[model samples]
Each structure stands twice: as C-alpha cells, then as structure tokens.
Target: MTSEEFGAAPTRGRRLRTVVVFHLADVTGPAKSLRPRLEAIARRGGGLDVLAPAEGSLAGAYGDLGTVCALPYASLTVPRTPREAARAVRSFARDVGLFRRELHRRRPNVVVVVTTALPAALIAARLEHLPTVVYVGETFPSRATDGTVRWLGGRVIARLCEALADRLVCCSETVARQFVRLGSTVTIYPGISRIYAEGDRAGFRARYGLEAASPVIAVVGNLTAGRGQDTAVRALALIRERLPGAQLVIAGLPHPRPIDEAFAASVHDLASELGVERSVVFTGFVERVADVYAAADVVVNPARFDEPFGRVALEALTAGRPVVASAVGAIPEVLRDGRDVLLVPRDDPVALAEAVSRLVEDPALRDRLVAEGSRRVESEFGEEAGIEAFEGVIADVLEQRSNGPRSRSSSPG
Candidate 1:
C-alpha cells in the first residue's frame, strides 16, 4: 500500500468515532477547556467516550461526555515514599486494563489521550488498530516534580509515545516545540473554551459586594506561587497611591500545597500594612468565572513564570474586558501589546501597577482592547476554533492510516 492509495478515500467531510482518555483526577484549566470541544464533537454525531481517574471531579466531568470509565491514577504529591511509587505503578496497570476494555467495546477510529500516562494508551491503540491522538496540554515532566529516576523514566516513555502517536495536539506552541524538537511530528492547538457569560453587572457586583464605579482588578486561577497573585497584591499597593479608590477582586482556589499559604497570608498582611486591605477581596473559587470577569474593570494574569498560555486572558477577552498579561510563551502570540492586551514583564509589581494604571486612566484604550480582543477570541481561540483544530488532526491521522502500509516505531511498538 502506498500513501497516495491510502488517502484516496475521501475523509475531508467524514466524522470519526473518538474516545478521549483523561485520567487526571483534578480539574485543571486544560481539562475544563477540552470538555466543551468534546461535547461539541459528540453533538456532531461523533461517538465520544471519556475515561478518567476513577474519582472526584473527573468522574463528575465524565458524565458530561459519553460513557465514563474511571481507573486508579496517583498524583505526584501525597505519599512520597517507595510505597507511593508502588501504588502509582499499580494504578497505571489498572488504567491500562481499563483502556483495553474500552478499546474492545467501542473500537473507536481514534483514541485521544490527554495525559502523560501514554504507555497504556499507545499499547491499547496498537492492539486495537486504532489511531491515537495525544493532546499535550502543557510541558511534560517539568510541570510536576518527580524524582530523577521517575523523571528519566517518564521522558523515555514520552519520547516513545511521541513516535507512536498518529497526531499530536498541544495547548501552545511552546509545548508543541518540546515534541517537535525531538523530530516528532505535532501541531499547535491553543487551549480554549467559551466563558460562562450569564451574570449582569449588578448581579456580579452584588455577589462580591463590589462598588459599581470602583476600579476592579480581577485575578482568576489557582492561587499558587508561580501564578503571581502576590505580584497583583503588591501592585494593588501601588495602584492605591494613584487611584485611592481602586479594589482588587481575587477569584481562585488556593493551591493544594501549603506553599501558597504563606504567600496568601502575606497578601492579606501587605494589604493591611499598606492600609488597602479593605480594597482587597478574595472570593475563593467561584463556579462561574465569567461572573467575576463581568464584574471587573480589568483582568490580570501576571504569572511569574512562562505560562504555556493564559486561559484567563481569553476569558477576559470573551467577557469584553481588557487584560494585562505577562509577555511570555504563547500569550504574546495571542496578544498585540497596547492593542489587544497590555503586556508587562513577569513578576514585576511596579510594571503590573503601571499597566493597570494605563488601562484604568485611559478609558478609550481599555474599551478598544476589550472590543478587539473579544472579536479575536471568538474567531480564533474559542470552542469553535478548538474543535476545528481537533477535527483537522483526526482527519490527517486517518488519511495517513488509510493511504499506506503503517510505519511502526520500535520505541513504543
């Protein structure tokens, strides 16, 4: 069989049956964004089944998709001893079995795996003769902390999976390069989702008891160290000196680790010390993120490190709000500094404050950004764009499979 002969079948308009595996127990940004796209795909007459870690948020989120399969998957945290490693290994084995069972039943055309548990999915896809589509939502290995032994083992496994994958979908260009650097074929698919736009301005302001006319600066995401909430708090101190009536509205859950505890405490203490504590409000983890975005005048995503991409920036754009984000990663790709978003250096409270000031003082610039960014997001980075990108990858993979004798990679084969 030759490539040309295999691709002769018209797949340009064909809908494929897909089973997406997300064996992560927690609800991270990536999972939240991917869910709507899968839902949309399922609605379009594509068979969709989700297999997740057999507990917590994953189980609940799975209900939104097709049939849900839950299995054991341990986190890097919790029980760092040798016993924990044994538990993780056991969990991986169980997930492999679950994958096999699902593959047997559905016999899907493609299996979309979304996590680093690639060994099991790759094997199952091979055994079932199913093309595998792997979505790399973030940097592999670096995002989490594991021992040197485990990290090295994971890297080897990831490289093997890369070669075996029929198509790779990454959340950002930075993440896609990690695979591409190793000469693995991949495509850049931005992490995107539709914002929950419901609450009116009055309703949102009342929900948080915020003033109608006060300059409201909103921060959304896990209140982790690298997320740069502390930078926002410090910036608030600077904003107070100029605008005195400025308020900071924080809507996010705290990190699981106590590392953020000290930082959270300091944010409050600094607010009090600067006599601006009354201006600082913390609404810990609101279900409707759009409500917060709607209520705020401006949104800030001042992550200290290079974020793969800032979902909040898109959400703010969706909500018709101006954003001040760090000039890092794929964020710069989405934003045009001073036009769509005000780009600032990461972790610099002074710079964050300056950008915030420009937006607050200049109403024309803020409104211009809000209008332009909203259009950009709706057209380029919303659920619509995400689904199209996903569908494109599926088409390419199936076309490749149909047109030729399969090339096997010994790495994962």
Candidate 2:
C-alpha cells in the first residue's frame, strides 16, 4: 500500500463508532502500547467500546476512554490430544455465537481485533459486513516440541485474517512478512514514552537496596522460558565471577498460565542451583518499569524464540541503557550488533555474560550504544508517529468500506 492510500483524511464531522476486541483481560504490553491509539481515536470524534475476556486492569484502565465490556472469547490453540481438539471446537463455536451477539447489539461501524490469537471476532465481523482490522504482534511458536502443530495453527489464523479482516496492522516487518499474501498488511512499530529517559536512578537504586557502586544487569519481561530469564540467571553466575558485585534484576511477573508459571518456578530454581539467588533480585510486576532501567548498568534480552518485536530492548535504549539481546527476529532489524546494541546468540549464557561484562568495563562503548539507540527511538518510534500510522489504518479501512467492495487486483490469488 502506498502512503497516499493511507494518508487520505478521515471524513469530517462524523463520529466513527469502533469496537475493539482483545483476547486477554490483563494489562499486557500490547494493551499498554495501544492506549495512545485508542485515546487518539476518541479525540478524533470516535466512539470506543472495548471488549476483553473479563473485567480487570485492562478494562479499568480504558474505562474513561469509552464503554468497557467483558466478553469471554476463545483463542486458537494447538491441540495435542483428542480431548483438547474436541474442547477447542466447542469453545470456538460458543465464542463465535457470543461475539456475533455482542456485535449485533453494539452495531459498530468498525471492528478491531487486537491480536490474531482471537479469530472469532473477525469471523463475526465478516458475517456482519463490518470493516475489521486485526492487529498482529505475536510470533507464533515454530521451534517448540509441538512446532509442527503450532506452525500449522498459526498459518490457519493468518489465512483467516487475510480472508476476513479488511486490514492487518503488524507491529513489525518481521510479523508482516508472515502475511505476504495479505494486500492490506501495514507495519506500525509500537512506541515508547519519553518518560523512560527521565527515570530517577538514585531513587531507584535506593528503593531497591542496591549500592551506588554495584553493577546491575536488568532483564525486563514476564518470567517465561521463551523470554530466557534462566539464561540471564546462569549468565549472572558467570558475570559475578568477574564483577563480584554484579547483580541481576529479573523484572516483571509470571503470566497467569500454567506453562509460564512453571517456567517462572524453574527460573527461580535455576538461580538457586547456580548459587546466584542472593545476587539475583526478582521484582514481580513493576508498576514503574523505567526505574528498573534507571537502576541498571546494562539490560539483557536473551530471548529463546523469534521475538516478533523486542519492546524491552527499545524501552532499555530509550532509558539510556546499553542492551545485550539475542540476534532474533526484529531485534537485529532495529538494532545493530555493535553500534546501537550488542547482539548475541540466542540462549547462550556465556555470550550474554561476556557482552554484559564488556558493557560494564567499557564506558565509552556503552555511551555510544546508548546515544545511537536513543536517537533511533526518538526519530522513528515516537508516540506521535505510531498514533498517526494507527489512525491512518483505521481511517483507510473505514473509507474503503464506505466505497463498497475493495479492489482485489493487488491481492494474491
């Protein structure tokens, strides 16, 4: 799609009624990143109705924006057993009926599905002939034990969005590449607040009980195996051997899933086994995550999977910290190996440790990476730019719907 297509001004003097659907009820990264976009919509004389699985922090945060409703929906999952397959079918059918009823009651002009995990909303919106936009940020699992099943399920969801939704808004080019056949795929990177650069380092260190002279390495993300918190913990053991006062701060809470919970426990156990428990601090669900960045000498993102977009790296860079991240997915796309950030092999504790240690020892190198990384974020991924792109997508989708059927000459057969 050309810039002209999306740059068309929205119809003036008409309030656009929009309904946004989300799969999760918690205040997740995607939900937080989307807040500014939703606020922009409201500012543009748009009516907002937010839907999620249940009423929780997400609903409460968006209450002022518009009406917040609890609508339980089923997400697509790879079924490994016969029982799971049967359950998935039943849940999907029930969710489609529920979503259809909700859409009918609301009668929105546009339907926005926040994640590809939930396809019931898209199907329902297609049936209602409402313009739909699916925002995809997730990189489906393709390297796990059930890689084949998970990969197949992800392709099915991708095809569903391509066939049903009027537009697909991807968080990164890495994600957009997966929907190569979708004509309306647009990449809009999520933005970070400038507040990250303004955190109080002294206050954060004081509150966390860390000495001013100690070297701190922070790994910020939910506690999960895919996030590679265990790798960081093991790397901490090696890091402490050189810099005895080095501390690893594991930030964020465990997701409310059984696999994530177990992974979190395993990370703690691994820290204990490596005798780095005392040197590692676990701050569960930090309200002000910038503080963790402020208190850190270096931030490590040792992700084990193909991260769709490494938001943690951006946040760290925006906070003026040098990042040591895995060379996976969009990380390398946005950050350079030695210039903006250090890229290490995935799940390699030795490389991660070595990179962190280098940052600790070389102040000039750290300053260079921090400067370059922050500059890139300011120029390309600011909040205003993201909001503009998002609003453009919504406007374009609405315009197309108003003009009747869209031209399929640009789409693949």
TM-score of each: 0.81, 0.93
List residue ranges in candidate 2 displaced over 4 A: 1-14, 143-146, 405-413
Candidate 1 lDDT over residue span 1-413, tens digit each: 23343244536456556787775665777777677667766776657777765565666775766777666543333235789778767766775665676676666666888865556777667766667877776554443444576556656656777777876677777767666435354554554455445546778788777988899999998777768887899999999899888999888766555777777777778778877788889988677777888888889998875676678898788878899998877788767887789999987899999999989999999899988887787777756667776667777788777765544322221
Q: Which candidate is the best by TM-score?
A: 2
Worst 10 residues of 1 by lDDT: 404-413
Worst window of 10 by summed lDDT in candidate 2? 404-413
lDDT measured at residue 125 in model 2 versus the true structure, 0 to 100: 77
Candidate 1 deviation (Cα RMSD): 5.1
> What are the lDDT scores of the predictions, listed in order?
0.73, 0.84
Residues 41-143, model 2: lDDT tens digits: 7766657899988777787779889998887676788888999999999998888878887877776767889999888888777766678999887887674
TM-score attained by model 2: 0.93
